[model samples]
Target: MANGKSLMTGLLVGGVIGGLATILTAPSSGRDLRTQLKQNKQKLESILIQLKDDSISLKESVVKTAQESAVVLKDVTADLQKSIQTWQEEIEPHKAELQKEISQIEEKIKELEQTLNK
Candidate 1:
């Protein structure tokens, strides 16, 4: 987008400089010169209007793409969060059972040690 703007600016400046040089170098009468300048001005105006329309269209496309990307990102984030929550829930029962078994083993080892000491 920035490149497009820079190119457009360069074209506009170059056109103006070239037009002025051409007008100055032309060996025409005053009336013809005035008529040529008027025609050039109108042509420039038309080019500017077309450029403005093109810029507006490019901007709209960029905005629409950004909006679609944002929505997709939001959906992906939500899906990932839900998947993590589901995995946590699925693992919780096994985690609790493993903890219970560990506690029972510890109690048995302690009792065995006490019995051996006695």
Candidate 2:
């Protein structure tokens, strides 16, 4: 992109130099040259205006795309949070049941040890 911009700048500079050289060497009177320069300036102004409009359109398109992406990201984040919460809820009861079974096993082991000691 930088290369392309530099090339365009070089081309524009070369064209301007060539045009000035031509105008200086022309056989026309000063008044005719001034008129031609005025016309060229108007054309350049019109082109600048068109380029400005195009730049604005491009910026708007970029902004819209970013906004849409942000909305999608927000929705995806919400779904992920909800899924994590649901998984936690589903696992909690099983965890509690396992703890209860472990306690029962420990109690049976203690009872067996007491009987053997008698």
Q: Give RMSD to native, each candidate.
A: 4.5, 6.3
- TM-score (C-alpha) between model 2 and the true structure: 0.51
lDDT tens readout by residue for model 2, 19-73: 7997989899899999988887787677667766876897799999999999999
- Name the regions of candidate 1 deviating beyond 4 angstroms: 79-118
> What are the runs in model 2 whose C-alpha is more than 4 Å off?
1-15, 79-118
Q: On residues 20-97, what C-alpha lDDT tens digit does candidate 1 reach at each position?
A: 898889999999999999999999999999999988998999999999999999999999999999999999999999
Clashes (N, CA, C under 3 Å) per candidate? 0, 0
Question: How many clashes (backbone atoms < 3 Å, residues ≥3 apart in a chain or on different chains) does model 2 have?
Answer: 0
All models: lDDT?
Answer: 0.96, 0.86
- TM-scores of the candidates in the order shown: 0.61, 0.51
